[model samples]
Target chain A: MSLLAKASAAHLAQLMGPLDSPAFDWLRTPETGGVMVRGRMGGAGAPFNLGEITVTRCALTLRAGGAVGHAYVQGRDKTHAQQAALVDALMQTDAAATIRTTVLEPLQKAAKDRNDSRARKAAATKVDFFTMVRGED
Target chain B: MYVAVKGGERAIDNAHAWLAEERRGDLGVAEMSLEQIREQLSLAVNRVMAEGSLYDADLAALAIKQSRGDLIEAIFLIRAYRTTLPRFGASLPVETEEMACDRRISATFKDLPGGQILGPTFDYTHRLLDFKLAAEGQGGAAAEAPASGAPLPHVTEFLNKEGLIQQEVASDETPPDLTREPLEFPANRPLRLQSLTRGDEGFVLSMAYSTQRGYARNHAFVGELRIGRCAVEMEVPELGFAVEIGEIELTECETVNQFQGSKTEPAQFTRGYGLVFGQAERKAISMALVDRALRWEELGEDNVGSPAQDEEFVLSHADNIQATGFLEHIKLPHYVDFQSELELVRKLRAEATEAMSEAAE
Candidate 1:
């Protein structure tokens, strides 16, 4: 669920590789909303309202199997919400293994690679701070 | 006094239509894409998100475009859009200690764990404008090195461990939301932080600067300023556990201040913290300074009568949307009120004339 939520909507749609004709019926139609994000004071203290982030959420049941699924993704991408919910529902069905290999694997790998590259770039900027000394000692 | 005057329906519609045309600027110029604004004009988007109190880069970019690059106006658009959203629920507080830092530096320490990384910063760049950029030229590539990806320890934590600095108390109580409830006097630290995070950058910066100029001056050191990304997570009732929904770039500043301890306890360093949306370092720094000034009372410091120390005054005027609404509303027609004032002046003049004549007679 976390990986799916973090995955880009376009990426998810591509990984989904086209939907079955009405693959899942909406238990609750996908909708956009806001979620007030909080942050702690001084990083370890009481929480405070930082601000709100747009969220899109939905619930659905698979057409083939009666497995119900729910998703809450960041941002106002309703289609992304539907795709995430679809993935959630499909994961519970007999196709769980196939979906995990195709969808979940790629998303996780991409996320890791992106994080690694960014960390590397940041690490490059770390100051070595070579110390220069006089012969007084 | 204001009077309702109707009917500029055609003019309003035409003005809007003209605005749409004006927004296009030159037909020859390629229309600006949201992606371009999000990427290139990221700082602008960051300010809008910070002030607008919403952290959606695409939406912020759209607001910037629609407002024609006016940040305050862009903020207004975002604030307007925020009201239309259905709030699902509040998320658990974000743990910034675990942030994947792109840039992290400390003014107090010469070197620390997760060494000072000056990510993409405008700090050392000469003020000279590069003409190559004007011609849309590409810059040189950046160098990359291996990273351990371990969480960088907070610089203040070092001071904290030795009891040289005051410790932050953890609380389970939920902080009040100013949007949900009206801001009242003697606001708590959490409320002040919230207001400061979303406060107009210019206003907050000025207030912070005033502190540096000796207004409620709190001797401050930038204990740490880090720009990075953190995961936002919320608990799923069905799953009965928290899950990461997304990630957001953040700038966190912690200012260690000189604390003259009260009679009850010995003196130790105090803290003023600032955390905001995106890599908005300037605002974060300023916020930390002002936060320290505002903590004067609780820290047992003197009430030095500074603007930053006055929470009601600062928070009340910090919102750009409210400030602009009140300021801009004056441009609206006040004909009826003006006419009444004119009549009163005329009446006074007539009375003066009658009194002079009677005195002469």
Candidate 2:
């Protein structure tokens, strides 16, 4: 996944906190719309339309470098999509290295930490069984 | 003659007002919080989530409050709200074998890999109502068991090893979504199961019961039933890998039915599967039975013309939202149609009198 794509909405929102708003033109204004969800039978079987879910998508081009970025996020959070698009555009420019270290790295670590904690909690509930050896057998 | 009734706006408004007042039921009592319903009346919230097909406990509780404890009404509210939301993507099929189960049991085996954990169930509870619960400050915390640390194995896997159960071939085809497209007749197993999972609990239970009473009877054994939370993952095409999206509570049931042997195939036990949102064992078990009954054609069994075996009948009427809408629409104005019926009856009566008079003359 692209660095911007890997960053979750929560992480991206936090990353955008200190950065000054860069001038950009809206290639596509953030719009809330429905997307059809499809599911495959047994995960590996024939696919079928599940239902429509709300999504917010936006596209923007950085005024200086003309780096275009697009983002789509689940639910109707328009600001999340806008900020995500900006991050996507920034990732393609000279600021890529700095952004990777400052934003992406921390976000990735947080996500990994969250996953590990959940796994630990679930692991606590795991059980193992063994059969008793029968003397008759 | 039936005349069209008009000017019901005032009456409708007054009725709504009365309902709101009744819902409050004396402002002297404290208003019920959504949190209370979510925590205390959790089973109702679970039922709403299962039938509604939306797994948000808070929203389900809110729906319960808004509907004045009418579960069907709460389910309808959730369904209506669900349609407006956009779907992002489908999650990877949940692995039930990896479930951190709160409840797990199998009738086929006495002791499985993971010992049967009964969890919180009303199975052993006495039918006598606990009047003390009605009084305030009478509630107490129940005992808790230490979490197990062993992974549970499926009972069907044991049969599979001995080549005694039918082999399920994995396919790459997509299943049809009942919510998006208008339901078509002669539906496949995936479509049938999907409908059954979100189907009305009472309706599905009755249909399953009918099968047990010799209507398309497929002697079923509860192979395994598990209720727990599973992680949801989604494939990111851009990233070229699937990532964990979230987790959801689910109830899964697998039933082994009667043996069947065909000309081309050997005799082996058939399987029926059901997976639903929340800890809904009854719904899941019923779903599995109905699922197995509907597999008559593929299993090379005779069509006994049973309601359980009828795919079109079961799928079409299973949804409570659709059933209630059609049932309740009778309250709407039908004067035009009723007037036409009245005119026809009057004309027929007049003709009969004229013919009688002519015969007398």
Interface RMSD, candidates in the order listed: 0.7, 5.5
Score candidate 1 by lDDT.
0.90
Q: Model 1, B164-240: lDDT tens per residue?
A: 99899999788999989999988999999999999999999999999999898888999999999899999877678
Per-candidate Cα lDDT values, in order, are: 0.90, 0.76
What lDDT is reached at residue A88 by model 2? Answer: 78
TM-score of chain A of each: 0.94, 0.85
Model 1 regions more than 4 Å off: A18-22, B1-3, B263-265, B352-361
Candidate 2 residues B1-361, lDDT tens each? 4675679899999999999999888899999999899999988998998788776677889999989999999999989988866565565556667776777778888777776667667767897988887766575644444444567787788888999987666655656777767889889887887788888999999999999999999999998888876655567454457755345677878888876676555788888877777788999899889989998888888888999999999999999999999999998888798879899999999999999999999
How do the residues A1-52 of candidate 1 rate in per-residue lDDT, one tens digit apiece? 8888888989998988654634677888988888889999888889999999
Error of 2 at B151 (Å): 2.1
Instruction: Provide the lDDT at B78 for model 1.
Output: 97
| Candidate maximizing lDDT | 1
- Compute the DockQ of candidate 2: 0.17
DockQ of every predicted complex: 0.89, 0.17
